[model samples]
Target: MEKNKKVVILNILLVGTIILNLFIFTSRMRFFPWFIEDAWGYLGVFLTAPILIGIYFMLRHFHKQQLVTSTNKVIPLFVAATSLIIVFMPTTDFLNIVAIVINAASVFLAANFLFNQNGGKNNYGFSRLKNQS
Candidate 1:
């Protein structure tokens, strides 16, 4: 995907994940009187996390001008696999545990990727361009 398009997709995924988290939190905490409990609601919450991780890697790939390492790419696959397992067997608590572990590993890989690329510095900011001498 093109850089600009990938950036846009990443932003959308990020926003969606935030919204999903809010809904889940509110539903669990009974903070929102208008919160409707439904099967689709939980499905959306569960699916957004993996999608966000996948988009992060995709954007990273575009930013670096190279494909992410094979191991890194597998994070999304693991997320998807766990998601499928949960979908097939939503009542199984063990599947949720597996999914959590997979997501945690993906997060670790993403952090490592970012830190390595930026030499352990915060590279997610804007800076004024130097004036031509």
Candidate 2:
């Protein structure tokens, strides 16, 4: 129960952070308070979701085990959904760019897991699988 609670809190915090970052990014642009160099590096803020979602799916659903398609697919689907959520909107702020990049990474991962569950090649790095194969 404690672990579950922790996971829930962590997930909430992660999401909150992303949203807050986006809000801050937008606010910063209004007054031009941020340095040009700072804003320049913030283009890929949306990718955070995809990356985290992918890892979360792999851990929660895969058990780090390789399985044939038509087996359990719930986690992969969850991952895709999360990926979509993380990748909500694009922002020009550095922080937003980082978040977007993470989100996009998650999308790739979720898609990979989804495909793998459907008997497709595993592109989302299942590091353990390599040793087995």
Candidate 3:
């Protein structure tokens, strides 16, 4: 597949996994406290394994230094979603800690990629930060 397409797909997967993690975390906290236990937390880790793999692939693309103008548009959304999760999540357990780390890492990466020093008009560095008319 094309490189840009691959980046887009990876971004989608990353965002989807973050959303799922947030949903599971919130539901467990607010409504189904008993049903969501350590096992479920482990299950979330397992479910999020793809994100690790996706990051690996994304890193490969990043090494190539290809501009991901369209894919960059997803960064702010990812940052916002994960930030909300971090703000609302109760960090009282190991699983919560793991989730916090994941969200933080996602935010850091998106922010770094969005504002890389190499960013320029042509290279927008994979992020699409432009004003629409």
Candidate 4:
């Protein structure tokens, strides 16, 4: 599959995991407003996180099509970010951290693909001199 398509699939799975975890965790929580109070707010916020994240990534993905690109540096950056996310996941009740890690991986792969295809684009922005003689 194409790198970008794979990245989108990863993102969908990641977000699905997050939303699923939120629902599951909240269902098990005995002290945090079962039917009313903050439960609704919490649910909204939880759902919002992945939705918003998805929107951002989707925007970035499409934007990349419009004179957008990537680099090898982005791969390392994603690796570092994913590592941090893994390190922090064990401490949290929600699995959003896992989502972040997956997102990082997708981005890294996309970046790697981008860099491999365009060494010059990696070193600098897209050429504005295509108009030059």
TM-score of each: 0.47, 0.30, 0.46, 0.27
- Greater TM-score among 2 and 4 belongs to 2
- Point out the higher-scoring one by lDDT: 2 or 4: 4
In the range 59-103, model 3's lDDT, one tens digit per residue, is 455546755543454443454444444545554556455555666
Tens digits of per-residue lDDT for model 1 on 29-125?
2346745454344466466656756765675575476534455444444555555555566544465455445555555665555334433334554
TM-score of 4: 0.27
The lDDT of each candidate is 0.50, 0.42, 0.52, 0.45
Ranking under lDDT, best-scoring first? 3, 1, 4, 2
How many clashes in each candidate? 0, 29, 2, 0
TM-score of 3: 0.46
In Å, residue 93's CA in model 2 sits off its true spot by 12
Candidate 1 wrong stretches, greater than 4 Å = 1-41, 45-67, 118-133
* RMSD (CA, Å), each prediction: 7.7, 13.0, 8.6, 11.4
Superposed by TM-score, candidate 3 places the C-alpha of residue 99 at a distance from the truth, in angstroms, of 2.5
Best by TM-score: 1
lDDT of 2 by residue, 75-126 (tens): 3344335434444545335644554455445345444544334343355645
